[model samples]
Target chain A: MNIYNKVYFVLLFITLISYLGGFGKKPRYVRMVILLMILWFFTSAVAIYLVKYGGLTNNLFVFHISTPLEYVILSMLFRDVIVNKAIKRIILLSVPFFVALSVLFSVFIQPVDTNNSNIIIIESVILVFISLFFLREILLLQQVTVLHRFPMFWICVGILFYYTGNLVIEGMLNYMIRQSMELARRTYRFGYIFKYLLFILFIIGAFCSKSPRLLTKKEQ
Target chain B: MIISVTVVLLILLFFIVSFLFIYKNRQVRHRAEMESVKEKYNQEILKTQLEIREQTMKNISEEIHDNVGQVLSLVVLSLSAIELNDTTKAAAKIESTTKLVEKVVSDLRNLSKTLDADNVANVGLVAIIKFELELLEKTGVYRTLFRLSGTEKKLNGSKEIVLYRIIQESLNNIIKHAKATMIKISLDFSDTQLQVEITDDGKGFDAGDSGEKNMHRSGAGIKNMKKRANLIGGSLAVKSVPSMGTTVSMIIPFSPAG
Candidate 1:
């Protein structure tokens, strides 16, 4: 790590200490902090792995599978207390979300020929699901206070972009019906870039959580 | 271009992650400070109230010790001469002294009861207000009527204490200055708001025209009532109509307030 990267770790180390402190004392609240600390650990681990191992190609396995698995775990964590029922419904809809994610990895199975019709269908279905989820979250729970809404919003956008980009990747690499690298793939690269932005937003927004008291207490 | 885009993306990601870490820590610090402030505020209010109650009780205690105790002692000393040879006059004097002592004892008991509250369980807002009504009735100065409408649930200790103090202070103001006939106290609670209205058929004052120096001479008991209301995220308003009496209204609204 460089100087700035080293500085980030120092902040990470302090967060780790706070997280450790959380186990012992019960303030009015500390769950949000503990959740952030876990995210930091994973994030720092990713940075370290990138520095140590080199290339997305070398570790495509974890790079692909882990994110969808993380979302599934999150869906469970925010299970019932999520006031926004649509978020839960979207999480269920993401059954296809992870399946489409797995399809992207399966496409790598035929790495020599990336143009496959099944990959296009899977990616398209995911994009549709993501757009629907985003619209529902925005419309239904825009004002509802909850623990998961912020992170869920960004996750919706990220999935949308990830699916859209991967769809284009499948079309270009697998389909040779027409091939012009610069002209055909502009939107695809843009989508991939946008997905990264959404991922960063998701991680940061998770820090804005409050405790879940949705069904247990009547909100006035 | 890819290298530049990649570099920028990595930099942005780093900053967002860094900000998230700092923000989380900042929240912890802010929450800790808020709790201490709340606790400290609770302590300060408790201390002030203790001082005031202690001062009032001490004054009453001293009055009883000096005046009532001395009278009773004199009666006891006079009655000790039971063997006074002049049977008729001596017996009569003894009987008078005994009655004097009994009167003093009753007055002493009233002094203790007059200060308020038998115990912690009895001093809540509802209980204290009911006591004020009974005391007003005994005075025959003005009949005090009380109407309470609420479950009295979710009234935490801090809220209860502050409210009880406010009502006590306001009623004290009415009895002392507002030469009124009847005082009506109503404490109404709803989901969104809690309201207390104390109205009297006494000589009222102009709400706007504050005779501050005069009020200072008499002690700003009304100002203290207002301060108590303000402390609990509420307001106190006193309205008067010359010979028509005065009404003091206190309103406290719970959060997500409208």
Candidate 2:
């Protein structure tokens, strides 16, 4: 394995261990995030095995099937955390619609033999909007006093960072490949940085306890 | 291509770091705002406590000069006039003196009960308010009426004190400026809220008038009452029409945990 894959596996392993350690202690959202991480680990391992050892040239179909499932889980996570009724309704409605679009794009546009760049770009955009909306709502409500200690806030930051990076990189991936294959591979390696950030932040969020109120002078 | 991708990644990192920086700044601002609000609330509570104490002292002074002092003077006069020679006259004088002394003792006891502003919690809000109305009735100036509907629920001690002070301030306002003959106070209790209405059949001023003269007349007292109400998470509304009397309505939410 190359240095990139080695680091990727190491981060994935650590995140999985951290999540499993907190599985019974954390909230439902944390458990949902653990499930998403497990799905990623499973698909990634299977795809790597088939490509490296099973003699299959393309294992992009595994991600094609997993992408919509991941989106559904993420939408559920957003729906669970967002308090605004209108935004929640929009998330609730978008799940089925996005799933349909992903299926159609996979069947006709990307064909599951190539990287699902278009579908990823779309998913990343939607998630970026949701995460921004969640952050704005958190800012307006001022419910959590210590933002750093708030689990949902950190989870939101992770989502915003990952999806934003994903959106930009995936939007340009196809064009980059047409210009130069080596450059495309190098650019694609940068996507792993975002993935590492997502899981590392997720681990931080999974371990976070409920934030305590700021202490007054008497309390101190 | 590599250069472009690297620039894009750099820009994305900058965007995230800026977001975190902005969010942290807002968090600090929010914390400072909350502390200031809490400080203001504490100051108001202390001020309200002082005002209640001052008002109680004034009431005690008035009761002594008007009721207890006069009655005691009469008792002394009756005792001094009693003759040891005539049994019938002496008995009559003694009897009247006894009655007068009894009344002084009763009035003193009632005044003492109201002396401690903090006793509102132990005596209960309804009883304290009723005692206040009874004291007003004793003046024989303004006819006072009190009505209560629904089951009485106890609130937090500090909140009860604040509510009582607001009501006392309202009554004081009516006495000082309303020039009204009758006052009605009603408390309506629901499952989640308490509604209080104080009405006076007085020569009321125009509430809509924001002129300097009108503001000078009743501005500070009304503003203080409203502020006290708000500090306790309640709302107060004063509705008055010239010559049509005035009504002060207040609504406070009830928290069972408190």
Candidate 3:
């Protein structure tokens, strides 16, 4: 396998480990999100492999099928962390709006057969804001003695890095594709590798204790 | 240009993440330190309370053995000496025995009241101190004087308990160690503070003699008294000179916490 394929497969392995490790321990929403990520990774890996070897153009449709689900799961994961009632309501309302917008934009504006830069950028922005807000609330409200060991802290860090880096690359993807396909492919693969490397953080988060209180183990 | 911008953005992201990590680390450490201090203070308060309870129990045992036991032994002696045939003398003996039994009952009632820890808490500080002085004076060894001035305002229950213990400890020390003839206690209430002074005409230890060697031996009692005072946001001063009296003065600010 190429380095890109190796990286992608490593991420898949890690996500599977994280999903299984989170069983009974992590919050229900976290487990659900990890399960969805595992499915997305497995399907995307298979689709990419098939497209490269069998010369099938229809494999890209798997991404189209998974993208909306990913957005909804990401929003679900964040709803537990956000404290403000109004902000939480907005996030809860945005999931349906995001799904509807993605459908309309893919059908009429960007087409289902190609990469949807508009939806990708919107998703990145929303996910990034959620991550940032989670970090802000953690510092403001939590009496965290050890920051890195906290499960939510690791999750926020992972989301922030992945979405912020993805925002820059994904926003310019269409233009890069038109100008130079090789350069565009290289940039996309670089982003993909970076994104998977950061999933190590999610695995770390899954292994880490998710208690927000300092006296959790002490109380027990 | 795109490469440069990505590099700059990535650097900015790294900085932001690093700064947050450092900030969180500092905050958590500070909170942990504060929690440790709080835990230590609570432990001290608990220890002092337990010690006071143990001391009170010891005093109660002594009181019962010395005072109540002697009175009851007298009643037994009076009952054993009854002459049934001499009716006039028997009636007078019976009347005297009844009076002695009633006095014993009153003493037992007073002792039981002192045993109640809740009573000590709810009782005003001045009343508690005055009761202690009365008990001391009843012993007939030390001449006790209590002086109270200014309109007294009540402190919180726990603070009163602590302050009362501090004074009680000093009196016990005087009774045990000082061969003093007179013990005087004064409580003065100002607009913003309450001051207490207890002085004894006992053979006093030298104040300058509390060197490092004597700290654990001679100064532990004073340290304990000061600690209890500090727990109630009060200050304690001990002054003593050889052949002169020892005096303990505590100044507590009037606050809702007390």
Candidate 4:
């Protein structure tokens, strides 16, 4: 693994540790995020091992399988946090539709062997929209007096930054690769910075979480 | 290419920083707004408490003058007429005077118990309101009816006081202006809310005169009633029609404490 991959794994490790420290206290949606992070850690490890040691030239197919799963997990997280009933129902209904679209794009258009830029771009767009929508809702709510202390607010911010960066980087990946593989590799390495940012924000979110029991009592 | 990539990253960072700044700014503004609301609510509560005290004192003054004073004056006349030589007659006079004295004591006791601000919490809102209606009935000028439905629930003491004052203000308006012979007050308690309706049969004014101009022309009683209701997270509505009388309705949500 390169130095960037090593550093990425370290950040992921720190995020997981932070999440574990607050595992019992964190709300259900936050626990789901911990699960997502764990799944991501394992999938990333496996994908890297396949590329470096399993005699595989490319591990883009791993992402093809993981992308829809990641979307489902993140969508579920949003569904829980968002208060609007109709928006919640739409988010619920869109999950299967999103998965089907991802499958179709993988099988017919992009193919699993190539970098799944199309799926990543679509995923990025949908997630960025949802994140922005969540931020808007939180702003309107005005319930949380201290927004920084709110775990979901930080998570939403993290999602916004990560997905927005992903949208731009992945949108250019295929074109960059076709023009010059060296340039694509350089650009892809830059995308790791957002991953680092996502993990750091996740750590902050984990630490910011108040125990659900305490929250319930405070509300009462 | 490197500079373009740097610019994109810089823009992204700037967007995030701006969002944080905006969010923090909005949060500060929200906190300030909430503090102002709380301050206004506290002031209203203080004002309501003072109003209740003032109303209680006024009721006591009126009772002493109209009822107790008249009864005591009659007792004084009865005692002064008793003669030593007419023993049997004097005994009868003494017996009636003793009875009158007992009644005066009872009336004073009841008045003290009901009119004291502290007893509002002790007697509960319904009993206090029922007592008020009973006093109106005793006047003989107006027939007052108090009907209560649903299970009675106790609320926070301050909230109860504010509610009582709102009801008192409504009744005061009726007594001063309604010229209605019959007054009806109904309290309906549901799981979620307590609804109070006060209806009077008298010469009513134009309900449509409730515009801003009319509100200023009429008086501050209705506006004050509405403000008191809102202070306790409740609502007040006044409906009046010329020759059809006026009805004041107030609804208060049951708090978790209730």
Candidate 5:
């Protein structure tokens, strides 16, 4: 196993730790994000293993299934943070639209055997936009003092980091794969670093106190 | 080309993250500043409340001593001098003593009403101010007049209490320092505001000169009154000329209930 796989395994352990540590009890949104993350880790890990050893070469299938699910869950989580009823409704409405587009593109517009560049590009761009929007919304929320302590803030940061990195590398993914499989795999390893950064942020958010003034109270 | 693009995108992302971090820092700092201001405002309010309570206690102590104690002492003297066998003289002394006792009871009742903080709100500001003027008039120290104009309108409860205390502080000052022969308090209620003017024809000093030079002298009291006016969202303006008169005016805004 490479360093990327090692980090992935660590992430799995972290997820289990978060659950056992009861990070999922109080805040409904955090619990949903954690569960979605756990699901993504397991599903992706299984897909990678099958492609490598079990001779299942259709690696893009996993993404076709999981990427849209990730977007929907993250959007649902953001809905909890958003104060405006109208903006929240737009986010909710976008979920079904994105899910259908993902399905149709993976099935018809883009072939599943090759790198799903078109779907990946669309997902990366949409996720980046949503993440940035969330960050702006969090900024406008005056009640929040310490941004890092806020679970939604960390979640937005993680998404923004991951997708921003993913957008760059994945944009050239198909071309890179056609040139050299080894080069493409190496570039993906770099992307995995961003994935690691995202999970680390998730871990921090999970352990963060639920109360806004928890740190201030501790200081007092 | 792809590697170069990737590096550039990564750098752009880094910059975006940095910007967000900076924005978050600014927000946290702003929130901290707001919290501190709110805390200071709360502390001032608490201090004002404590001072009002202290002043009330002091007034109550003086009332019990100067008025009630003196009258009761006279009652004691009159009863002691009574000859038991002299029925006619004894009856006359007894009647005078009864009148003195009745005066003591009435004074005690008025003092009790002043002591009850709720009574200030319950009796209404107009009636309370009238009673205060009556007390001053009874003392025969100052010729006091209370005039009410326009329809009386009730205000926010706390605002009323604070306004009353401000008036009380002004009265205390007039008695102690102004050496006024005549005091007039006028309550004018308009559509949106209530104006209370407490004017005294006394040995008045320059209002501006005193506020600045004597902030340490009698300025603390003035500061206290101003702080209270700000607390109740009212404006307190003091105008005085040496030997002409002094007027302490408070304009309090009230929203009518539909």
Candidate 6:
């Protein structure tokens, strides 16, 4: 819609390509983790664009897909953590809590005291659940040995770096607290730039690691 | 109205792109994984084939060294014992060459006898091994010994050939390189395993360095033995300490039908 948004979208698209390119002979689960992260960023950007620019996108299904998608991705990435009976029960209990939280945040919670209270109330329900799922996914990843294994460790590092880039775009959406508007804008630029750098790092790390030899998976 | 139509179109396009990317990427990755696994399997099959070929060669060598070699010595002895006058001394010289020709004949026989497919089904394993050792013992150079413990039973021909080849190769190693006097061969059937041990008091080489030092490619012997063992679903090990002695053990799982 604007020059700044155009630049942001371009940066985001580049990051998406880099993420797609990470799929060398990496195992299925590891590849899934990266894919989910990319989806999160991509969809988040789309959601932000929809909210800022008036689009006739009024259907509930448009944004509702994110919640279910996030839930599935989070479950897969942290199956080890969520697989436990107690933990699954807890997650099940958290579903309603997330629904409530999303509604509350989208409406009552102030991001620099927003002017449009009605719009906030509606989107907050979806945002709360998606954020919860994403956070749990990250937490589950912590339990998985992805960070410790040879090739995966590097991939994991790259993901973390790429996620840092998302923070830049996220900080600008004004959905969350921002100490300074100018600082938020600057952080957005820094984060996007950092994300691009991480994408490059992922390639370098993938090539250098001996995972292909160890797993005997050929990278095509 | 235009804006609403655009938004709906964008949402549908989003699903199409997501499905296309996920499906295309999955296809490529799956193909790659399958190819890698296929490559590894091929290498293993090739290695197994090489081992089988080597073992076949060793069996031929043993038949030559034990059976043919003995027959050649007898021919030489008979030639040496013949009385020849000066006039026939030249003929005696000609007679000696006959033994040399017999050597070639016997070498050919060695090749044929070892590869004999009927050895598996005909005669059985015990008789074949007994026959091989009896031939070697007739040499009188080394008193070769055979001792068996545990229940006696007929084994699958492939298993027999493998065990026989292993025994044949270890003895060949002792006969060719290990300059030892007494060679003891024993078979023990215990713990669902058929264990064959051969010990020689020959000028034993250090086994720690045997693998590294014996770079002199006499591998037609040891290589064949290992390959035969592998084919028979067994493992072979050789232990040699310098100057003391050398021991070769072959373990073939027999019970529960290994």
The C-alpha TM-scores of every prediction are 0.52, 0.83, 0.52, 0.86, 0.54, 0.34
Selected candidate, larger DockQ, 3 vs 5: 5
Poorest stretch of ten by lDDT in candidate 2 chain B: B209-218
Please list the C-alpha lDDT of all candidates, in the order they appear: 0.58, 0.84, 0.78, 0.84, 0.77, 0.56
Q: Once superposed on the true structure, which residue ranges of model 4 sit more than 4 Å away at CA?
A: A22-25, A49-58, A82-90, A133-150, A208-220, B1-29, B117-119, B209-219
Worst 10-residue lDDT window for candidate 5 chain A reads: A211-220
Candidate 2 reaches a DockQ of: 0.28
Query: In candidate 6, which residue pairs get closer than 3 Å at backbone N, Cα or C atoms, i.e. clash?
Result: A102-A124, A102-A125, A103-A125, A106-A120, A106-A121, A106-A124, A107-A121, B180-B202
- lDDT per residue for candidate 3 within A1-220, as digits (tens), equals 5777777777767766765762356675577656667766766677877788878866656666677888888887788667778878989999999999999988898787788778888998999998888887767655565666677777777778788878989887888999999989877876864466467767777677655445342321
DockQ, computed on Cα atoms, for candidate 5 = 0.10
User: Which lDDT value does model 5 have at A156?
Assistant: 73
TM-score of 5: 0.54
lDDT of 1 by residue, A1-220 (tens): 6544465555555544543442454322134334544664675578468658864434333434444444444444333324566766766776666666565655565331233345345545655454555444444432333423344444444445445555655555434336566644553444445444544544444443422233222321
Which is better, 3 or 5, measured by TM-score? 5
Candidate 5, residue B217: lDDT:
47
Candidate 6 Cα errors over 4 Å, as ranges? A1-220, B1-118, B152-155, B208-220, B254-257
- Candidate 5 stretches with Cα past 4 Å from truth are A1-7, A14-30, A49-56, A80-90, A104-108, A111-123, A133-155, A174-189, A203-220, B1-28, B43-100, B118-258
Better of 1 and 5 by lDDT: 5
Worst ten in a row by lDDT for model 2 chain A: A211-220
TM-score of each model's chain B: 0.69, 0.85, 0.84, 0.86, 0.78, 0.53
True contacts kept of each: 0.00, 0.23, 0.00, 0.54, 0.15, 0.00
Instruction: Report the C-alpha lDDT of model 6 over B224-256, residue by residue, as the tens digit.
Output: 666667766788777777788788888888744
- DockQ values per model: 0.05, 0.28, 0.04, 0.43, 0.10, 0.02
Q: Which lDDT tens digits does candidate 2 get at residues A1-220?
A: 6887888888878877876772246656767787888888889889999999999999999999999999999999999988899999999999899999999999999999999999999999999999999988877766665666777776787888889888878988899999999888977898887887777777777567543354454332
Candidate order by DockQ, decreasing, is 4, 2, 5, 1, 3, 6
The per-candidate count of clashes, in order, stands at 6, 0, 1, 0, 0, 8
- iRMSD (Å), candidate 2: 4.5
